[model samples]
Target: MPGSGANKTHAVVEGGSIFIQKLNSSLWAEANEKKILLGQLISMYSELLKTIFKNKRSKHVKDIIAALEVYKTHYSDGMKKAEELLQLAKLPMNDAKIELKAIMELRTVLLEMNKEEVRRKRRSRAQNPRGRPNLSG
Candidate 1:
């Protein structure tokens, strides 16, 4: 429900012929520019991954799997980012695909990080669960 203040706000907006609308339009165009840049960054990282695992296959399979898991998570998160940017800018959905891709790639890295950490902790505990026996004792 629009209040009296709301009515007045509309009136102010309506009074502007071209300038206000253009300003509002440009705001989102700027946002899209940044969003695409972020996407490009993601693409670059994906390329890096390709290079790292380009040749060696079997040895790093577990690592690659972990990384792919992370990528999946990040990709999902990227979709969420895209949704959010759309909602925020009130712009069309087409422009945000790249940013969303970046976001997902980030998720992939995070997944790998989590899996690696879990394995590391388990190994650490197996090696030394109690610690050096409290020297004071």
Candidate 2:
């Protein structure tokens, strides 16, 4: 969760490729730290799955489980990709093109996660505006 807030902020920004490139540069500058943060996210998502499963009879339980499973898969893949990037970073003579490609791939994963977060926020807000729905109908 190290860059969680920043990721949200980037997702909210409306601009072109330059803005995205800036975000990518920031991410690459702290790639190792981001990798650790991704690992922590994976663990947190796994724990969330376990907690949801404990409530077996909740409404829309199947939907919730499915969504969480997808999120977990995304985080797991992100962690693996980040690890690969870290290893590539440690090589004696890394190819700049290859490193750039890897960094872009990792950035893609983070962007997708950011999109999901935004979608979830919108859905929640639509479901419960002002924290409650009108009872008089």
Candidate 3:
């Protein structure tokens, strides 16, 4: 939960690399440079499974469990699509449109999240322009 309240902005950078920036901070990283191993993924998935089991009443618990199982079956396809995205990123923008539906969808999701973050920041500023309590009696 270290980044629980921090906003992350993801970007596709030069050389087909993916970068993530933490808003209002100097934290930044090239995400794609670090390959996530199966062990790490399995550990995270196991943690999620434990959490779901502990919170059986969580909304859509059954559906979430089922989706996690199904994701295992499509691991190869996911890997392939990720590779295709990396390849596509190396090409010129115009020539990169073909067979990039997944990447485009991902881009859409990121853009929407970024827009929401911007909207939330605007609302926060409007609510408290000084970024602190008025502290008036």
Candidate 4:
């Protein structure tokens, strides 16, 4: 909860923003769904990590943690980086020169994340041809 306060402030600011163009209801709904999914994933991952740590001495637990680390890097980091880049892109451009450079750098980071995520998914599927196990049940 280290950043909870900042998130609340950001939510307030973002919620109060004025839009020149009318918002698309479908896209907004999709975004909300995605946010909910991301939050659930983060919460589940955190709990899993805590449980894994309790059995860190086991080789299998260590392996699971390693895999989770890869998932964190490829998925969580990528999503957060993309979200940040989007926010930066939305800002009004006062200094085009500086803003362009920052945007380009963020774009490169986002592209790299996408490539890594694709590679990870391909490797995962290759390792388990039957696909990921059902966790919902």
Count of residue pairs whose backbone atoms collide, per candidate:
7, 0, 0, 0
Q: What TM-score, to 2 decimals, does candidate 2 have?
A: 0.27
Per-model TM values vs. the true structure: 0.24, 0.27, 0.24, 0.27
lDDT to native, each model: 0.62, 0.67, 0.55, 0.65
Model 4 spans > 4 angstroms off = 1-43, 77-137
RMSD, candidate 2, Å: 18.0
Q: Which ten residues in a row have the lowest lDDT in candidate 3?
A: 19-28
Question: After best superposition, candidate 3 residue 116: deviation in angstroms?
Answer: 0.4
- Backbone clash pairs for candidate 3 read none
Q: Cα RMSD (Å) between model 3 and the true structure?
A: 16.0
Can you list the residue pairs that collide in candidate 4? none
Expressed as tens digits, the lDDT of each residue in 9-70 for candidate 3 is 22223334322232122331223322223323434564677685885646576666666566
Off by over 4 Å in 2: 1-43, 52-57, 82-137
Residue-wise C-alpha lDDT for candidate 4, range 77-114, written one tens digit per residue: 54665567679788777789877887879978899999
Winner by TM-score between candidate 2 and candidate 1: 2
In model 3, the runs with Cα more than 4 Å from the true position are: 1-101, 134-137
